[model samples]
Target: MERRKGTIVNVGSITALAPGPWAGVYSASKAALHALSDSLRVELKSFGINVMTVAPGGTKSNLGNSSAAKYDQTHDWKYYKKYEEGLRARTEISQGPGSTPAEELAKKVVASVLKKNPPAWFAYGQFSAILSVLYYAPLWFRDYFYRLVMKC
Candidate 1:
């Protein structure tokens, strides 16, 4: 890496920006990565390395299906039993019809990262805009929106 300048692309999720119900752990992990990327970007700049954080929203992929497979919606719950279906649905939310194709996102990322001046942050895929809005929205508005959408 010291011989030649290169870009380090860190893939995160939109959840890191505006976390919602039933995916706190996942969101938190991604948020950590986002933070790390931000710090690394500055720390590595003097070394001729560019760090780019990619926060993808809902993109078409098997991740959702795989996650849904492992989820046991039938399991007994102590507090969120009433929201079982909603919780399970969280895993499949990104697989919806409007989700962006993974290939499309991949191509964009590749092109962006290869540029002489790559952006520090690149966010794409469905729900990216909405999530960004939620990220900047008032706390009460975000809370109300999530409650209404999650039906919780």
Candidate 2:
């Protein structure tokens, strides 16, 4: 009734492609996962294992609320105290009005993963396309764009 292989799906983030001002650690972690998945896709191929990386953008989830709650707990900003509001706003960036519905993203992921020949890389959600494009943009341009949007 069902067929399942040894597939490893790493849930990455579109943020990995473009590191923003207040989300350094989150972006870095996702970027690291992307790198790991890339390597594993090849390394595990001979063993009949497939690795897929899903890079989701602003999809509807409780992550924004959780991030906000965590940010609320931190009071010591020191040198970065003046930009607290912007930092807080960054927490809710993925949960904005334009955010993708979680169900939609789930459906896409499931459909892709269930295919006979699954893809090695997949990205979906609100800012997915733009962020993918941003991956190819110049460093200076990306920096200016992030600074303008994140208000850093």
Candidate 3:
């Protein structure tokens, strides 16, 4: 990352900060990007290379509609079935009405890349805020909070 001089907008997600029901893998992947950005920023800052991390919130897109495994409701993880309704509800969030238009996000992203002084990290939309907190919270705090919020 330090070898070149250019802007790198790493696409993170609310999942990275807050890992919740039915999307552990997705969240972890995004979280990895966030962590990577944290390291890369310092490593590349002196070289005039801007490494920014953008965490997008809920937006209407096909990303979640098509997940890793589209297993039928009849066949699911044993313990997970107990929280099936909650899982479905959480999954629906990405496609919910509050979703920021994808184009809107893309436009902002492009503008950020073209900025004279781009932000170190940019988070847009709903869950992005929660994820930021989760990224800084204690382990017990995050776990208990999730349990209380989901009632599971």
Q: Which candidate is the best by lDDT?
A: 1
Q: Best by TM-score, which number?
A: 1
The C-alpha stretches of model 2 lying farther than 4 A from their native spots are 1-5
Query: In each prediction, how many residue pairs overlap at the backbone (N, C-alpha, C within less than 3 A)?
Result: 0, 0, 0
lDDT for model 3? 0.79
Residues 17-44, candidate 1: write the lDDT tens digits: 9999888999999999999999999999
Q: What is candidate 1's CA lDDT for residue 100? A: 86
Estimate, for each residue in 19-62, the C-alpha lDDT of model 3 and write its tens digit: 87567888889889899999999898888898899988998788
lDDT of 2 by residue, 8-97 (tens): 899999999988788889999999999999999988887778899999989888988898887556767576678877887798888899
Ranking by lDDT: 1, 2, 3
Candidate 3 deviation (Cα RMSD) = 2.9
Q: For model 2, what is the alpha-carbon lDDT of residue 64? A: 87
